[model samples]
Target chain A: MKVITIVLQIGFLYVFYITGSLLQRLFHLPIPGSIIGLFLLFIVLLLKVFPATWIETGSAFLLDYLSLLFVPATTGVMNYFDLFAGHTIWLFIITMISTLIVMIFSGHTSRLLARYREKRREGTECQQSLSESSL
Target chain B: MSTVLIGIVFISLTVFIYLFMTRLYHRFYIPFLIPALTSTVAVVFLLIIMEVSYDTYMIGGQWIDALLGPAIVALAYPLYNQRHLLLKNLYPILGGVVVGSLTGIFSGLLLAQSLGFNEKLLFSLLPKSVTTPVAMQIADGVGGLPALSVLFVMTAGFTGVVVGPYILYWFRLDSPLAKGMAFGSASHAIGTAKAIEYGDYTTSVSSVAMTLSAIACSVFGSLVVLVFYA
Candidate 1:
């Protein structure tokens, strides 16, 4: 019974994916159907159209083995060895450098924004305390 | 081997290898020893040594591949769960992901171009920071090889997981939100897994950032492709 429930939940997730594909074709959107499905599911959840429990177990199971699902696609790189043959080192350097840059850029950007928000909150709290003391 | 037999053998082989690699990763706790990276290398090596062509391996591999779409859709659950936190810190998360996604796309393009990479390779590398499926889709739309884009995405993911922590510490990006944003925007899901070590809040924020970054990358990536390729 437990296995069947999980299977059915996964099947339910697939329904969203099919709907996304259909919408993509109908709208001629540039976005992928899977992504469209993701947005659709997110919206449905946000609106409380269905309880989260409906897909909880299924999503958990899939997220657990998410890395495993990537193996086949990653392995597809075998057929394209020629593309990386002469440029392996350059590719490595570029990816590493760009990744580092992005991490730092995004990290610092959020950190600064978070700090600013924290300071603003603290300032408001301080003002409220001051006003209360005066009263 | 018959088609059915090949599919069963390769699918089982991949599962077995992934399980073994997961065990190894848990034991060593090394950043580079991630199951995804190690198992993929192991499977590719096995296929090559057995004189098996990629097509035959894919015959079985496609079964697993078919699950990727739904798995991606399943990402919505985490994003949904984190809705409260996402709403509370909307500005920081949105600001960080937007900056990160644009930087990821443009920087990759500039670096690849500077290195004299060919047009096909350059476009393939454009979506490197996105999660695999979205990256592959964007790559295809932009005249790049989707398979090759996967390779670049894996590289970017591994690099982020391996190096991201040190950079975060070195720069004192100590906030949970900042750490999560950095990993998710720069490296996608692999980095999100790494974010688990930090704590639950970090993990939640990371998953949220990962999803938003994918959307942001898709938009920015498409625009870049259009401006240059069209």
Candidate 2:
């Protein structure tokens, strides 16, 4: 029973994958087919076209082992080991600095916006209180 | 043994080493001891010392690599689970991700270009802010070496996970939403792991931010590529 259910879940995912690939080929999309497939799955789930239970188990199982799948590609970096020789320090510095910059700017912007909304609400509340007191 | 058998052996060996190292990392609780980074480094060294060709290693490695697509597609489940939170906080989430992703790309490209890195390297570095699967796709779409982009994304992930908390505290940004966006936008999944340390709210928000950034990149990242390569 478990095995059959898992197979059905995989079948559902494969359908989305095929849909994504077909769309990409027809439209010449720059995005990866798998991501397009993800969007398809997301939309279907959003609209209740497919019950989440249909794919949840299989997706959870796959995602659970997701990091394992990356090992091969992570090891593929060896092919470019020579590229790292001259640029290792530079690459490290650039990635570190850029990530830091991203964190700072994104966090700062979100916080600033949050603070602004809070202040506006507070201002409106103050005005309401003042008018009630005057009355 | 046949090459195919050898490849399978290598895969098992790598998985064993990775799992072992992860347990060690958890026991010790050291940032630099990340299982992925440490295992990659160790395996690379082992291969070099043993005179095993990378192609030989990849015989098994490619099998694992192929799963990246499905694994990435499965991300939709988690994203779907958090859909309501995403919609509720859509404005700030979108605002932070768009700005952060653009900031990541521009900063990496300009810095590399100024330092005289080749165009290929520039393309590889462009998607450093995203998760590995999405990063690889964006890199390949933009004519970069997908393998090289993996390296860059891992570095970005490591750096973001390590330095992200300090940066957040340094800037005095305490909101869960802000913290989550910062990690998800800058580092992707590994950073999201760091965000999870805070609470469920931060984790869900980080997941939404990471998902948003991937969609934004897939849609607009190509435009950045077209501007350069076209």
**Could you tell me the lDDT of residue B61 within candidate 2?**
78
True contacts kept of 1: 0.78
- lDDT, candidate 1, B1-230, per-residue tens: 68999999999999999999999988998877878789989999999999999899999999998887887788788778877877888899889998898888888889889888888888888888988878887888888988877888888888888778778889888888888988888888778767767766786678777878888887888898889867
Interface RMSD of each: 1.8, 2.5
Say which candidate scores most in lDDT: 1
lDDT value, residue A107 of candidate 2: 81
Model 2 agreement with the true structure over B1-230: per-residue lDDT tens digits: 79889988898878888888778878987667767677777788888899988889988778776666665667677778877766767777778888888888889989989998888888888888888767887888888888878888888887877777778888986888898989888888767656656665676677667777877776667787778657
| lDDT tens readout by residue for model 1, A1-135 | 878878998999999999998998899875678878988999999899999999999988887887888889788778877766675568767988898899899888888887899899999999999999999
RMSD of each: 2.4, 3.5
Q: What are the chain A TM-scores for all the models, listed individually?
A: 0.91, 0.78
The numbered model that scores best in TM-score is 1
Worst 10 residues of 2 chain B by lDDT: B192-201
Which regions of candidate 2 fall more than 4 Å away from where they truly are?
A1-11, A118-135, B116-124, B131-147, B172-176, B189-204, B215-230
Model 2 residue pairs with clashes? none
